[model samples]
Target: MLCANSAGRCEFDGCNKYIFYDNITAKKLNASNVAHIVAASPDGPRGDKTRSYLLSDKLENLMLLCPQHHKMIDDYVEDYPEELLLEMKKKHEDSIREMCDLIFVPKSERVIFFSPIKNVSLTHIDNQLTAQALLPQKRPASTCGINISIESAFDYNTSEYWSDIDNQLKRDFDRKIGNELDSDPNTIFSVFPLAPIPLIIKLGYLFMDKTNVDIYQKKRVPDTWKWIETRKTNSFSVNRIVVRAGSNIALIISLTAEINPKRVTDIVDADIIYIISAERIGVDAISSIDDLSDFWHVYQTVCDEIKNKECAVETSVFPAIPVSAAFEIGRRYMPGIYPKLHIYDDYNGFCKTLTIGGDC
Candidate 1:
């Protein structure tokens, strides 16, 4: 019972090594030792006169451990006390049981997308990191990644480059994502997006909500794409700067990182320029789905204003945001109600703009 509960592993606090084989040699052997939490004799390590007599031969006092850990625990009785051993055994067994329960749970499919960012030569999303992020809570459907990235001419900052990428994304998404949904309409996807901010948005737009999708953002401090719980999520602020009142609206999104208004004003001329920034702006500003929903609340407010006034013919967007937020922006955008999006990317310095909602 003890061995089965411990999953045939060492029940030591820090060591859960399987004891079914020799550690050094490539040979199958049972290296398990059944140790007594309360020793059989009163003089033994952590021995008690009553417990040694009562629990010595009982299942409650037995622990499945590796040879090394079993010897160490018995030799160093003071360090590995009866209380500690009992706790460790319980924890190991409970964890193993939990894992067994998860075997029947359905797993989420991994979807990866990558692109070349200017000045940043390295753009790789390690599969292990993505897998680790989806742990005890969510399991991966398969080790194979549904890769949607296409080869390019390494030609950024050109019309041909943008044009080629735009078509490639649509084609691959149709082939990879569309075909999958056709076979099984109820598939769940966990999305890991690492691409140019504008392209990430476009990818989100193409993806839509055909299936249940989970968005992942690569964090800065804990340098991974896993979501962490912060003391507080992001709160946004909207600063309206109306240069002249006509029909043109310019939006500056500074959530993942802050941006200077002059950067947007210098190139694109607009009547009313909106600066929507997070109260605490940085890479880790957003922590959960609620945070992203909060951003949409603010964005929707701006949209409501635009729709109410009914003057703005088009909206120019200059964004310095996270991949998740950028993706959300594209996904949430209304092509019929909202005006066309003139997107200015970080790279290319205002050259070769990407157009969304106006792709007719």
Candidate 2:
């Protein structure tokens, strides 16, 4: 099933060479190699004495690859470690699974247009099937001219604006979508985000683990929109805590030592603080699994504390964390209860550019 979904292509990043080809003689040539994440032999590259006994021929330890990657990983085991290979295998398989699900699932004919931001024209959302528009109370003339009634609105300049209306937005989404889903559970949601990124992230958090929804973005091309897919899963098990520094604010727990606590504190004012040094640090980023696990533990602890109310959360990433880890943190947000994140970029010793988490 996995190989079929992959279409006989190599799973390595940026290496999509076909595994099989037809020769001029009409012969079907096979060039695929099943690469083991752990070496089959104790003396082989990335070899583990225990893994050789347990997973030497296990299918779970194998990944389909072309001859090039198979030889490359085996010859340069230190460069292509076991953990990295396992991550690659999981992502490739997940991509294939997502593609298959999209093809097999029968999507509902109804399309829900949820656009709070007043950036795109409503004509872009016109399509077959019944269409419903959810817009803000006072939007620009372009979006205001639509047939939908205004349900909500927010200030784009205010930093804490999302915090005030996060709950309202979630309730609005549930009230509207709940009735729709009751009629047809497979209804597709085509969201157009013209609001702050945090609100968009909150919109997604509302649908976490409940529905498969598609968000959309308007391209530079006039009157055009593109579908955005959510790939991160909401399932996570970790402990959370609250390091109180002040009211309605929390810090992103750092497991890497590269994040200077003093520098972070100087940039964002918060009532709560959670700080930790990395177990193993890198110059540009932290890629250690052990370190990421520690960070997740701390993140869950904080989530447990703040999963009950809307708060203004500030996160400062120092050194740097893995993209996957950051994404997992975003995915774990508990819908209406999750805080409005104020993400910062540490540039020249200042926490700059507050990016609210969202597709917009």
Candidate 3:
């Protein structure tokens, strides 16, 4: 039961190493140690006079630790205090139990796609963080997920730096993801994207409506990959200005912050304009999955607006949105129905990063 609870791995928080065998050599190895949280002996590490006797051999006071951690904690009792040890042990066991419950639950392949935002402070995606985010709804499939990393050392600000980003995405994606889709096109993809708006949108665009995708937002405040435990409701307003009939229509999404009209006006010679803004906008505006659903509902309407035109009007998308929303924008863009999109990314200034549905 103890080994099962620890999932046959070390229970020292981040040190979740497997102890079954030498993975590289394929040799049987006793790589684990049964360590007492409150020492079985009174004078041992974290030993207590009364509690040591009470908890000796008790499952509650034991942890499945690797040999190294077992020795290190014994060596320095101060650093690995009783309370901290118990916390680690409890968290590890509870997490393991929760994971066990999800053995039969649906699995989602963690699709990781990221690029540098502002050419600084790139975010790292680990199974530890993404695993915590996947609970209650899906099981973490890190071992089998699709990973396509496109973090160029080149400056994101320079137009020349991004010329081949789409091509690279296609090449890597076709090599890894396209083959997977050919076998099982219905595979559920849990996308964790932290890239420029254009690339994420393109990522979503590539997936299209044909593929199943779950977008995970990286929250700014708590700095977590998990969705809010409870859904927080938000309200949005869609305002449109149809100046005159023309070949271009401007679709401006201002969710995180407001985008000045002049920025779009200077670049796009549009006859019609549509603005989708939240009642309250900020980094935390998109806090729940329901909020994304709300955006999707609004998004379909926007897509229909473009699709129903007498002639295919080219769409200019100027976005001030969270990464998740940008992705959805791409996912929903159907070539035959929706017009071509000239997606603008904010760097030093708005430079066209990608074009969706341009060919068809």
TM-score list, all predictions: 0.72, 0.33, 0.73
| lDDT at residue 240 of model 3 (Cα atoms) | 82
* Cα lDDT tens digits for candidate 2, 1-360: 547756687888768667787546666689888887887898887788888769987877888898989999988888999889888877777777765555644433222334443233333345321222222111111222222212334443343443445655656666776776787776655444444334454455565545654433443433333212223222223222344544545454343235555566566654455444343443212233333445566666665455444244434333243333443454455544545555553334534324433321
**Rank by TM-score, descending?**
3, 1, 2
Error of 3 at 218 (Å): 1.0
Pick out the ten consecutive residues of candidate 2 with the lowest summed lDDT: 132-141
Which sections of candidate 3 miss by over 4 Å? 1-99, 153-159
In candidate 2, position 43 carries an lDDT of 81
Residue 139 miss distance in model 1 (angstroms):
1.0
- Where is model 2 more than 4 Å wrong at Cα? 1-105, 109-164, 186-190, 221-224, 227-360
lDDT of every model, 2 decimals: 0.81, 0.51, 0.81
Each candidate's root-mean-square deviation in Å? 7.1, 19.5, 5.8
lDDT by residue (28-79, candidate 3, tens digit) is 8888899998899899988888999999989988889999899988998899
Misplaced by over 4 Å in model 1 are 1-99
